[model samples]
Target: MGSNEYFTEAVVLDKEPSGEFDSIAHLYTQELGRVSASVTSARKILSKLNSHLEPLNLVQVRLVEKNRFHVADVLKTGALDRQHLDALKLIKSITPEAQPDPELWHLIKTNLNEKDILSILGFDSQFAACLGCGLKKDLRFSINDLSYFCVACYDRLL
Candidate 1:
C-alpha cells in the first residue's frame, strides 16, 4: 500500500530535540486526536521547516505514516498572514519557548478547525460568571482557583 498522509489541523503540545538533528513533536491532530512525530531538522538557511516548527501555531502538515512515527512533510504554513504575522510574532516574544497553555491549546485547535474563534472566546469569558441570586457582569472569578463569588454568596452556597 502507498503511504498514508493526512490533511488536518494540529496544535503543538510539546517539542523536544531528538537525536543529533531531528526533533520530536507532540502534536494534537484533529483526525487522530493525539500523535507523536519526529520532524526533520531545518538546519540550513533555505529550510522551510524552520518556520513550521514553532509551537502555538495553527498549521496543516502532510505526513506519511510510518512504523515508529508519522513522518511529516510541511506543505505550507503562516495561517496568519504577513499582516497578521505581526500578531504571532508578538505573542511568541512574550511567551517562554517550549511551553504551551494546555487549556488554550485544546480550545484553539478545536475552535480553529470549527472556524469559531469568537464563540470559544465568548464561552470561556462568560462561563466565569457565578450562579447567584443577584450577580452582575462585574463579578470576578479565578478561572484557575474556581473562585466564583464574593464572601456573601459563599454563605448561601453552604
Candidate 2:
C-alpha cells in the first residue's frame, strides 16, 4: 500500500452514478465509519469492483485519500441476506459520516437486531411509544424522526 492508501473492512451501504463510468459508494467501515468513496469504472459491465460493492455485502476495501476518498480495490468478504440488508439500510440512515463507533461496527458484524442498534444509537425502546396514537404495540422505528410508531399508525402515513 502507498503512504496515502489504507485498507479496512466495510459494509457496502449504497452506490450512485457519478459522471458516466464512475460511481460514489457509501460504505460503513470498521475504521472510518460511514464514508463516501469514488469508485472508478464502477458502472462498466466488466468492472471487478462493481460486483463486490453491492449494497449490504461485507468487503475489504482499499481506499486512497486525496481531495476525497477513492476506492482502489474491493474484495467481498461476506454475503448478507435480505434481512441483514434491511438492517444495513437502517444503519446507513442513522449514522453520520466519518465518525467511527466500535459498538455500531460490532452490531453490524454480528446477529443484528433493531433493539440493539437503537440502543447503541442512544434510543431506549423501553420508553418508546407510537408517535401517532401513543400505543407501544407492534412498534416500528422511523429513521426520519428517530422515533417509534405502531404498525397501524406507520401504515397510515404511507
Candidate 3:
C-alpha cells in the first residue's frame, strides 16, 4: 500500500538472466498490459521470489514503478499447461512492450488453445478482414481470394 508500490495480476511472458543473481522479466499484466520488470537475486537459491517467476505462470505481484518496474513480491500464482506456455511465447514475440491490450489479455485468459493460437501465428489478409469487419464468427477463409467471410457475408456474395 506504499505510494511506490501497487498490486496486480500478471503472467510471465519471457525472461532473461541479469548479471548472475538477477533477472529481467517480460510480464503481461491485467492492469498494466506488458511490462519489463527487474527481479533482484532471482538466481539465488535462497531467494523466495524465484518460485513465482516462471513463464506462463499467472501471479499476483507487487510492482514498484520508478525508472522501470521492479518486482517487490509475488503474492499468488496461476497454472497453465505446456501448450499454453508455448502460445504465450508467441504472444510475447508479436506484442509491443509496455502496451496494454485487454482483448489480447482476454484471449490469453479464456481462449488459448493450439488451434486458436496457430491461427494467430498464420494470420493473413483473410483473418485481418474478418477482424476488421467484426465477422470473426462462422469463419470461412478463402485462400484463393485472400479473404474471410462469415456465413451472412458468404450468402450475400453468392
Top-down TM-score ranking: 2, 3, 1
lDDT of each: 0.50, 0.85, 0.71
For candidate 1, what is the lDDT?
A: 0.50
| Model 2 / residue 16 / CA error / Å | 2.2
Question: Which residue pairs clash within candidate 2?
Answer: none
Per-residue accuracy of model 3 over 93-112 as CA lDDT, tens digit each: 65567666776677778877
Error of 1 at 35 (Å): 0.9
| Tens digit per residue, CA lDDT, model 1, 1-158 | 56667766665545677878777766555565556677774556214663575655556766567554554565434443233333233222233332334544465534332212223334333445554644645554333333455446655556
Q: State the TM-score for model 3.
A: 0.67
Candidate achieving the largest TM-score:
2
Q: Please provide, for model 2 over 19-102, each residue's C-alpha lDDT reduced to its tens digit, 9 standing for 90 to 100.
A: 768888999998999999988743554277878989978999999988789998899999777777667778889888889999
Better of 2 and 3 by lDDT: 2
Model 2 poorest ten-residue lDDT run: 39-48
- What are the TM-scores, per candidate, against the unseen true structure? 0.46, 0.85, 0.67
- Per lDDT, the best of the predicted structures is 2
Q: Which stretches of candidate 1 lie over 4 Å from their true place?
A: 41-47, 75-106, 110-158
